[model samples]
Target chain A: MADRSASITSQFTGAGLGRSSLIFWALVGGLALLGGLLGDSYVRHIFILVFIWCIVIASWDLILGYAGIFNYAQLVFFAFGAYGSAMLSIYAGLTPLLAIGAAALVGAGIGVLVAVPSLRLKGEYVALFTFAVHLALPPLIQQGRAIGMGGNTGLLGIPWLNLFGFQVSSIDKLTWYWVSLAFGAVCVYLIYFVILRGRMGLAFIAMRDAETFAQAIGVNEYKYKLLAFVVSAVFTAVAGGIYAHYTSVVTPKVLGTEFFLMAMVMLAIGGMGRFPGAIAGVFTVVIGNELLRSFDDYRLLLLGVAVVVTVIFFPEGVAGAFKPKPPEKAE
Target chain B: MSLENVTIQFGPFRALTDLSFQIERGEILGVAGPNGAGKSTLMNVCTGGLHASRGRVLFNGKDVTGFKRHSRCGLGIAQTFQIPTLLSSVTVGENLLAGQMFGSEARGSAPDIPIQDILYLTQLEDTLNLPASQADLLTRKRIMLGAALATGPEIIFMDEPLGGLNAEEIVEFLQVIRHVREELGITIVMVEHKTRALAEIADRILIINFGEFVMLDRPEVVLNDDHVVEIYLGKKHDA
Candidate 1:
């Protein structure tokens, strides 16, 4: 499989080709060929996990990297999506597909809730709000009497999604993988091509650089900041739905601090605010973890050291090294 | 062209009180005062950077009190800070691009203005791709001016454009400011402590003392005013 960095490099070069039409066609054909070959169950499972994570990491970048809003409770939204879907399927008697949509809506709702307070705050204050949400979510789900969120045991027997007459069973990892890949691609394209290329993207950058200056230029900081959070939450929620369906379970453990920290590490390793960086970061951290699984406890310690080293030395991450330098002036 | 009894008080200290002034179009308004005279504060209120506690700011025959800073920029008003506020992480070209991106009215269309033109106007063509943080003091000032110009503003409020420049750099900056007003027909409102320097460029000068308008007249008349000499020049003499 092509690494995230490699994929980004290819995408960046796609426009520079002499004939854009031919380059696009050839690229589509290549992706199709690769997709066909990756239809095996085990390969499909790994790809699906990667694809789902790509969406989450990308959304995380949208808020943290682009807007420079350090939201610590990002996993809360994911948990909302997973728990929302699980509850809807088990109690509301809705299909997994409907549950997925509900999860996204619920996630958006939580985004609104979070943004209302967080948007007014910045730096450590915003981080505090998000951290509070992260601490509050799991216990709320466990102790809430009316919601019946399975207390601590969590939801089970989530019905498989049926497309037309075909039931997408848990064993059909290839099908799930393809769906996730398509969704991930669409999310990345929307974020990178549409939003980042539009007026909103400029506003985000302006806000990131200087909030006072951004306001001076007529950007309503509160409106745009909320928009970043809401959009990011929607993507993250969708990824959560994929995770829930893929694993056939939804639990409080999914919203653990460890998972959120892992996502942050992925973003830091990949590059902050750069679209390609998120994808690269996720794949590197995830694959690196798997590769070092033999060391068990030692693997986590190594990951921590790696993160510290990366922050200290290569603050721009691996992609920064590959970025094209400006040509030198003629002497 | 009005401020109706605008007062801004920070706890016990009042920054501005019942301050009022009118500025007509195509006018070069020079605001001169000592430090803590609320010169920058007044500019901030006018440009919507800081909201006036009890007054409305009218721009082009409309109330702009509620408008955000960028909206004020859209309404044909822009400003440069007392301290240069260039994005240190980005290149000079990127900084200009950001300004063009925000300041222009034409939505959806990418900024097509050549980076070279911006650099040329600011005398920074040689340093187009250099990181703003790496630029020297004078270069950073020029880049700030260039970024403001890239916005294509109809009116620009410059806060201490010649704050810390040497004689040679000040001459260069004066020429650039003159060229901008002449070439683009943009109205300039400058805040400066160097009365002689501003007198040479400004059409009209407004002297501010304790956040109140002390004198509003031709630069020569304001400079020669006995009160102006007694308050500002006398302090310099005493020091």
Candidate 2:
């Protein structure tokens, strides 16, 4: 029943941005720009890898953290982006940029496809259905060898991202790192500013905390859940498409349960719903994996211990560890 | 709005039976009953949360027996809960804003009532930025009521609006309820255990026992009835 003006204000001019928050993003942007000078492509590759994971993790936060829905299909959507883009560029001879865009659309389509059927389910049911899709997809793709996906080996030699003939390739990791950083920052800004600050954001939290009350007051649970999933999927797919271009390959491993667990662990360790925490989790897990590489097979073992310790000590995630200060003068 | 010979059954148990009543426009109707007396089930039927096994519900001269919860809300029927149902993590302002769009588009191009007026009517003008969880019980109750009001409903169903409040808080809430009637002219179906306070504001009170109407009359008559006094109020005016 809101008038046109309230809707306009809520959508466009979100709760005013605080000075501290603005400063925080500025600092983050400065640090991302400095990542270009991180020396060897080895270091820059890890940095670029963190940005790739950041997109996925932030999207997960949108559904899991803010909406408080435990969705397991995010990884599959991420892999969809990569695979869709890979197939388009390799099979259809489409331009790399156009392929990535197509992949994002494909991701959104799948997101709605899964979310619509599962919106009636809550908690574990959502997990079961989404996980079922995630687990059932890789094998389906693997069996599609005739479709040029290369079966178990996956599609290799996917072209790099080329903008007007400038190749953003893995050999020059700095360029890849910058591209991912820009995309990741955009995802974070959109999810945090537009979705979270709008009326839909309030509906999401309302539905989460008290569903019956939410319904009685007019919040549509199915619509909000679908919105969360679709928003999460579209971005996750774009990230995956870029990831395929960066790695120059698309594989089943990207859709594996293990990869989902890794991303979940990163999100949890950093803070399940917090934006900054998702980014922090990516760096900690990615860099920790890189640094512990000398231990070879034991790296995962050590990383597991660290994650368990974090869960034990800070179950809320690194972002959750910091409590919000009580409102000044009680508003 | 009226219910015609309604009956609600769950398995073998009849939660409500052979119930019928009419609500006058802009009237405040109070429902009183002991525990498990189906006081809530009656409210549930009107708000479209539960369906009567038999009967028709008429709202604004239309038979609404088949309407779902949201559809009923869209037609200007809204409700609050027994427990406080504020969105604890969000600000009071956001919570109020969330209630603005439900069933609203059904009204075509009619603009919604302003948010500031709701805040003022509910006496929450200064609490616009406070998280709902931080508010005290009385404020929480007001916020929930205001949220329902923001939906632009012509009628509001309140279940146990006075639960857990002290004598002072109860009096304050009654004032708000009275203000709601005087200012908004919104018809209300208030289900409560607070008989003494409820009697003053309610123009008519409906008493039910075992899902059957004991009496539906003026507050003074119903409160003074022998069976009502025996079952609900006992000897004293307090419940």
Candidate 3:
């Protein structure tokens, strides 16, 4: 029986069964099974938050990590989704579902605006432009209309998201958690399989290595860069919409510098540019934040220090530490 | 193909002023000039990397003035950089794959010409899986050539293909370039400072001085021209 079990394990982990592939599928199956069995509210809440953050970080990774655009304005898109949906729902008396669509559109629109100028700039220029957006957006939203956004107070009592008569708020916490998980999984797969596997992926990689060279080779750098930014914004918007409904609150604080810092910390601690790195980063930073809650003021300081140390020493991050070594070639 | 009245201005400096030249199909045109003589600027304009302030780049009887680089690549124009602009992290095969993806008519439909064939052509068969960063300068030059070849271009533009190579490596690369033109029947436009080496390979040499065409004729004539020797070549034969 031991030998049989060993053989089974070997079959799964052996050549042609790429370790990452096996691990990914195993994690998927295990998560599904475990999510079904563990119906606890606390566990469900934690996982839901994880899934929401996973979407944001993963999408963020798509731009910053893969496309090599270090955008610090990611949370602005998230806030746009949350606030856009909230405003549309509150002011227009629109359905929550319609508001979600509005959020996505708003996110995409902002993505285009940001990407158009920012894509041409790289390194510090990209960071500076994105940072300006992050700083400027909330005030613009606040000053625009007191009725729509509620100004400083922010829109309150935003209705729960409902889809085709299936009320998301009425659903069980476990079911909602599973829904979030599924959404996150689909986002990951779409980014990894659809975008990264095709010719677009090659173009993106080319852009990352050398933008001028990519252009010399005939790639339309601006078009593809905008595409990446827009897609990333869409995913981030979806995550924000989900988070808004889950919490029943949409505030300026949602798009605050705190969330931006948290995301940077998470990405840095997890790994920059790796797909699984985003998820791992989200979990580590979020869980670490929660666990260090007792320290209060010192918790943030510790987190900052940890991020710096991780970046300096292990630039590859936690996921880097665990990445499987490539198989040795035959002599 | 021809560049008619092309003028490129970079801020206060005019890189190329009223430069006009024609390169026929199935011809190797060698561009030789001083460091700032605008040889590269001309190539950049031709490849659509730089938009000239004024002029029309006519390729196969079509005005490609506003065409993007990739569109020009699709129209059968390709260029290699002076500095090897390879994706350093990826293998040589992957670099060639990128070239094939962008420039090849295959459009990612059928199986690519095998990696082994590309490697064998550049004598990089053993280095297929090796990252470009791992390769030596000569190997990198060959890989760059291999990548340009993989594009399936009708015309290949090379910038100093023999820059860092030793005598043996230069001979090897010369043979490869000849094979590409002879066996594959591809035209070449080369921006080279190595006049002697280029003269041996190029069918015609176009000499530029101070961003203007000084002389454009047969390699033998241009190289032995008294004016070229006095100004650019610096009285080498006279000395």
Best by lDDT: 2
True interface contacts retained by model 1: 0.25
Chain A TM-score per candidate? 0.87, 0.90, 0.86
Please state the error at residue A106 of candidate 1 in Å.
Answer: 2.4
Cα lDDT tens digits for candidate 3, B53-132: 99999988999888888777777777788888676756666677676666553222322334445555678766767766
**Can you tell me which runs of candidate 1 are displaced by over 4 Å?**
A1-44, A325-331, B87-97, B104-143, B146-152, B233-239
Candidate 2 lDDT over B2-119, as tens digits, reads 9999999999999999999899999999999888999999988998889889998999999988876766777888899889967887777667766775546433323255665676
Model 1, range A180-232, lDDT digits (tens) per residue? 77777777767765676566766787688766766654456778899998988
Residue-wise lDDT of candidate 3 within A1-331, one digit each (tens)? 1121111111111323356456766786677777888867777777788888988998888888888887888998898888878778777877877787788889899899889889678678999989898999789878956557767777678887676777777246876777778777777767765666556666777788867667655566777889888988988887887777777787788777688788888899999776677778998998788889899999999998889988988789987878666556444
Candidate 1 lDDT over B116-136, as tens digits, reads: 555656877667667676777
Error of 3 at B139 (Å): 3.4
CAPRI class assigned to model 3: acceptable
- In model 1, the Cα lDDT at residue A327 comes to 61
Per-prediction DockQ comes to: 0.33, 0.42, 0.28
Instruction: Point to the candidate with the largest TM-score.
Output: 2
Q: Residue A247 lDDT in model 1?
A: 81
Give the TM-scores of the predictions, in the order they appear: 0.86, 0.90, 0.88
Instruction: Give the alpha-carbon lDDT of every model.
Output: 0.76, 0.82, 0.78
TM-score of the second chain in candidate 1: 0.89
